[model samples]
Target: MSTLSKIEPTDATEPVAEVLAEVKKALGAVPNMAKTMAHSPALVRGWLALSGALSVGVIPAPVREQLALATAEYNDCEYCLSAHSFIGSKVAKLDPDEIERARHADSADPHAAALLALSDAIARGRGIVEDAALETARAAGVTDAEIAEVVGNLALNILTNYFNILADTDNEFPPVTPLAHA
Candidate 1:
């Protein structure tokens, strides 16, 4: 059971209902995470705005999904892990091996590996990232714009992860392998 009752689209009010409509249109359904967030209409709005901005940012969709997966795994959030895994595979077309590697913040692509390492560092370091980590990302051809996008993506995913943990939101998407810590 969830710690809070999810506000379903049918029961949502005003702004929440409007946002839920858009979410459903974009995602094919209102994910439980979004529904749980609808408990606070402002949060759902803010999340939608941030998510929309990040969708067109410099980072490619696959890398963004990879970062999300890595952040979810690091945070031990089952809801986010499952959600991102589904989107990462079906929408982003990431291979099973890529998704598995992403969970550990490792990737076969050099540039992606560096960004994934930085994503893990940001989560583990609590935003007190070391200079060497930044340098590594730069050396791997991650530009300033890309770095900023990575940070944004990490923040976005972390918000969902923390929310899912607090809400204990029911999984509405296909389940992924459980994290060892979970």
Candidate 2:
């Protein structure tokens, strides 16, 4: 159960319905999370804007997915953790073991271990990582632009994770639930 009241969908005309329509067209379904956001059109709109910004930002999709998954795990957001997990594996072709390994390691990737280490540091909210760690991330080929985008990725996941906790958004992606729980 959510601490926040569930907002049921209404067929009536409203900005929220427009957002819901866009969501439905995009996903072929009105996800419970979006529906919950429909309770406040502003929330849905904010999500849309932030999502668009992140997509157009400098981070590559794969790395952003990794950041998002890591952040969701940190927040214990069952819904988002599940959603992004599948997106990473099925859509992005990221190895399942890679994600599992990444979740616990400060250095998740053998080739790009430093980047993962930086991500882990960020996930821990250690706003002050060693200068050497930043140098390591740069050596691993992470750009200043990508670092900024990583911050956005963290923010987006934090938003969704907290929303799920507050809204108790039902899972739309089923396979992810067990993996997230484990």
Candidate 3:
């Protein structure tokens, strides 16, 4: 059970309902996590703003999704791990094997592998990534800017992961079901 109770669509009212309506229109469904976040509209709005800004950044969608999944896995966040895995497979066209490999931060390919390693390193709150790791990222064609973006993405995922743990948010998308507890 969730530590925070989700605000149901049926019970939404006034200012919160307005935001919930926008959330529904945008996502097609009010994810339980969003409902939990509705406890503080400012938090929800701030999260939305940050997400919007990040979406417009230079990182490829696949890389962004992979980073999110990797971060979630490192943090043991079932909610985000499940959600991002599904997004990785369906929205980003990442292969199932690749997704699983990313979840474990294990890969034969250096680029994908390096990204996983870098994301994991940041997820641990380690401010300084080793020079060799940065070199690996550079060899993968990742720029210093992209590395910074990955750090930002890592921070984003950590925020969401912590929120999921605190709220025990329910999974909304069906495709991620099998892997939710994996």
TM-score of structure candidate 1: 0.94
By TM-score, the candidates rank as 1, 3, 2
lDDT-sorted candidate list, best first: 1, 3, 2
Ten residues in a row with the worst lDDT in model 2? 103-112
Give the alpha carbon lDDT tens digit for every residue of 38-101 in model 2: 8777888788788878887876566667777777777777788778777878776778777675
Task: Identify the leading candidate in terms of TM-score.
Answer: 1
What are the clashing pairs of model 3?
none
TM-score of each candidate structure, all chains considered together: 0.94, 0.82, 0.87
Give the range where candidate 1 is weakest over 10 consecutive residues by summed lDDT: 173-182
Q: lDDT for each of the candidates?
A: 0.88, 0.70, 0.77
Question: Mind giving the per-residue lDDT tens digits that candidate 1 earns over 1-182?
Answer: 89988888988888889988888887688888889888787888788889889999888899889999998888888898998899999999999999999999999999999989988888788889999999998999989998788889888998999999999999988876557864
Q: Model 1: residues >4 Å from true position, as ranges?
A: none
Error of 2 at 138 (Å): 1.1
Whichever of 2 and 3 has more lDDT, that candidate is 3
Candidate with maximal lDDT: 1
